[model samples]
Target: MTDTTVLEQTQLPIGDWEFPRLEPRGYVEPRNRILKRTGYYGGPVKGAPSTSRQVEVLNQGILESPMQFEGLLSGVETLSKTPSVNDQFQAYALGLVDSPNVVEAGDVGVGKSTLMKCDYVLRALTLLRRRVVVVDKKQQSPTEPWGEYTNVAHTAGVDPIRLALGDRDGSRINMLDPALSQTRFIAGDTGALMVLQQAAALLNDGTPLDTWERKALRAALRDGAAQARARGRVVNIYDVLDHCGVISDELTRQMSPTALERMHEAGLTLRFILERLPEEMPGLFDGETSENVKLGEKLTVFDISQLPEDGPAVPLAMMLANAWTLGTIRRSEPGWKTTFCVDEGWFLVGGPMGKVIQSNAKLSRALGLSNVVNIHHISDIPADDPAVAFIKEAGTMHLFRQSKADDAVAAAQIAGLKPGAAEQLMTLPKGQHFKKVGLAAEVRIAHFRSELERQITDTSAGLTGAAL
Candidate 1:
């Protein structure tokens, strides 16, 4: 009933089934047609701002806009007579410009930390008027930043305040000031718990407390805090120790028989631990926080340089400093930027303080702050660590010459560089680094420091002076 034959037009092929791609068959006449490309070119285009105009906009953004920042210094292209477009220069310069966190890694003698201090941190302090808190852990060597950088800090009109633990003359930082604890608690921070944990860790050689011990310690701190409040005074660690020393019969009666038995043992163990802390760390945590320990200075350096790196003192000082900084910043006006410098980051990264540092990194942008973590190598950070998580959240990374191949490869991976770039990283000269900033391609920067910065940053200055 229906016509089964295909229509003549349908049978006629309009095009070949397998249309071959156009292949050049020798010389052919070139046809002239406008290509429709959809991308930006080097020069000005239809609806985009020019290079200089873009720079102007970026500068304007620095004032109050939500635009990203460019670098502190601009780069000059040397290969071509015509300068590269300023927009490209801005992008290249900002390649390693950090948002709120920067991770700088390299081997010894590679000038990684020096370059960061001289170039970025100093600029932030002097030009941007950002408050700086440095955890100075470098030992008393010719290259120690605490002593050597004093001149630079003075020149910047910042009288650097130093806190050296265990030094009788040094500023005292009480970790258990009830005022600080109560204020932070009222502000919704983990104040009482953090303080209790810090005290236990410092006492237990950085080990976590058992469940019963934690419960007992928490109860004692609460009671001590209440007693201190009644007397119109702030409680210290010693107050908690005193409360634990007298594990009250009234308090024990409220608990079940099993819980009471464990609680008593836990209280005794905690007392034993707390009593020995003052002996183990004499002149450091034995008394109230000194009046000299204030954050009103432009630069406050917790100079734990005298403390042994392998000991608990350094990390304890770091935790205290972290607490102080966070509380002070919380009270400060929002919009004022602060630079928190963690020199010799292994103290925080490889230790229990990494959790605090990780928390800081997460709130950095919201708090209008920047955290610089300078370490000798990526491997210094342990695997599956909160420190590693902090590094991953960093939008800026500066990698100096890596002496070890593994370090170079890890650095390359963090910077998102090509596989071949890892080899280049190992071969980079001193003061040169591969930097990545915010969604930008990696750039090689030859950092130049002034004579004063060189004098301030160079460790060999003292050696040369001694030689002379």
Candidate 2:
């Protein structure tokens, strides 16, 4: 009682105190000192809130704009909700791409072939109503003995033009066929002559023809064409082979003694090479293009899977088929678009053959054609090769997983991707790729497929035992 009375006398008055008194342990305030309020209440509010303060207000300009890839190719599983939709024609029309050319590079079993089959071939035909021609090199399987696209072509109600060495029933495409020469696509006789020279070079182990060799080859081709026209038939490789070593008096008159000797030697060497080509690659480029090798269908598959991988047959077949397809397209009426898909594109884009592919790519837009090249990796192609220029000129590129560090870096560099993209490319999962269209920034895309497409585009028949 004495302590409580002394404390109470020492406490200051509430109104006179500068600060609230500190309470002791177990202290309780009087009921009248405690503040109380009823349920819910608001202070007097003034004017309406400003638009900037409203939750619904948004800056439309700052919002991310959607990508305008018009054509529906696949679903995009990136940050954006837009589907991964684009084809060469639509991208070109939308001004999103400069050239109607596409390239796909990645490691094997990473879905390059599937994309080619689905997007470039099947979807191209069904969705866009465009024509597709596939230079199929991969064998269907160990038991099928046909191209991987054999079933795809059959699904489209057409048969693949199969080319096998020494098989009399196999299809043939004369590198010297006059149909290629007649169409001014790559330009008349000059185009045919180029094919011949390229074939000779391929036979010569990728060494281009020298001045003398070129002169000899040109003269022989001219003579062969004239002879074929006189005979009222198309010129074949055999016609050119017959005139290879024959030096006319005009050719002899134009050359000095030493030059004449060199030209003669060149002619003989070229003849020897051309002569041995049929023996080496029997049934190919030996006769006129087979009657069955027609582009009557919306899709045409030149099955060159039977050719030896390490030899010149693959490249020769690709070159001839490309030339033939271009000539046919040039002659066809306008408004219809075509896509030429070449798998194992390294074979077509190396050495002299690369120049032909490059020329075709340059003329892609004018001819209403799209060139789709599928290769293993950019690192596999030589840095100095002409294919490098063709690859760099592509308006669209699909980069899949590159297991090798160098390959990933090369893919990034070739596609002009930003920093850290190489690392992403190295780790990209199967069916996922980085798509770079024209000058736009590369976007990470996860390719989606339909159930029907999955069955038709499956290339793992050997592994999974799935029927196409």
Candidate 3:
């Protein structure tokens, strides 16, 4: 049997050609190693990407010393099918990026949706050398398909996998290893999965949080909780989950009667979460769900666009569980390299995600996970301090085009420049973005679109679908 894992890492047998020296990634080097861990936000620190920026050859460059070498250039012929081209697969074989995490920042319509394009990620897959896992939101429809591959690109080495939210437990996703089943599952209609997961854990561990942690979580779970308390007004479910994370109106319809009944029987109809994540939150595919969150050194994109406007409730649950399970990698299992990336990361931030990122960022490295998060804007995130800290620790950042005024302002403020430092922000063209690393010169990235856009419908699967 062709080992899909091995297949994912194989390189395109296309050349004796020299790869341009990776331009000095410079200061971001420390953070660059962030995504090397086996999974989730439990690693040293840093990160990777997609698009035209993912171009394989220099479309144009001054071959400094245009012919300092004469015979070095022959009538260039592609290295057709030799094991030599697989050199790039070493990292995967060596277990470099077992699970990868990431967070992207940009306003709506500016390609935040476009960021996870498969083409670039597939190119990156060649280097990381690991299986791919996709966690898109739970929706009524299937994910945008990405089927079909040019016989050429396939041989060139584009390996990947895709999974949808509606999947039953133990269902095999296209690119992910079937063995890579979720350890736990968290479920909720509201975006309070994090709170519930933590609440569940805190209860299990029998550890109560201090006042500050409670305050942070309350604020995170509900948008109007503080104001309600301040004004002596009533705070309800609508205020916390719905209004805050833009909770789903549809969730009301989808709420399972059996689960609700079970919850009531358990004497817990709802859960409230605050700061400290649980020791662990496990998942069950039979449908009794908990937040099934896991991290490893593989590129994991949790796309929430399909969810109701409320954002992702599951991540909170996963974060809570992770806070319990993987948090002890230091005492538990050392020498693991990992990176965690959260796409459209609003829900997790400030609520459960913010707490996890905050508690783990500085220390995760030794345990083998580096954390990277993507947000549409600074305001979308809940924590003032942690949000800024995450941006800084990310080492390398990409600023995609955004249409939001306030979010744009927040992005600039977090960047820590004068009032107008983000002036270029307004002028950014579609699919064009800005990039920065720890003290590295801020650069621009022109997202290279995957031809997959065309195959986003039926008949197209992995390399083709475009989720809108």
Query: Per-candidate TM vs. native?
Result: 0.74, 0.78, 0.44
lDDT (Cα, tens digit) per residue for candidate 2, span 287-370: 778888775368889998888888788778877787778777876767889898987787765566687788888888888888
* Cα misplacement distance, residue 275 of candidate 1 (Å): 2.4
* Candidate 3: residue 82 Cα off by (Å): 29
Q: Where is the poorest 10-residue window by lDDT in model 2? A: 11-20
The Cα local distance difference test for each model comes to 0.65, 0.79, 0.39
Q: Which regions of candidate 2 fall more than 4 Å away from where they truly are? A: 1-65, 127-129, 182-189, 226-232, 247-266, 348-350
Best candidate per lDDT, number? 2
lDDT of 1 by residue, 1-468 (tens): 322333221221211111123343445434333321333322465665579856775675322212234445412121111111111123323553445587888887777667556655676565544677877766435544354445556666665445554566766666776335532324422485676677677768878888888877877887777787787777777778877735567766787878777788898888888776577777777677877677646677677767667677777777777777776677666556667888678766656888888888777767666778887788656788898888888877778889889998888887688658889888877766666666766666555556556556655554465311
Instruction: Kindly list the per-residue Cα lDDT of model 3 for residues 136-250, writing each as its tens digit.
Output: 3323134533222222124434232222245343221111111222212222213233434344343434344443334333433445455446666444333343332232345
Write down the worst ten-residue block by lDDT for model 1: 78-87
Question: If the candidates were sorted by their TM-score against the true structure, best first, what order would they fall in?
Answer: 2, 1, 3
Between candidates 1 and 3, which one is better according to TM-score? 1
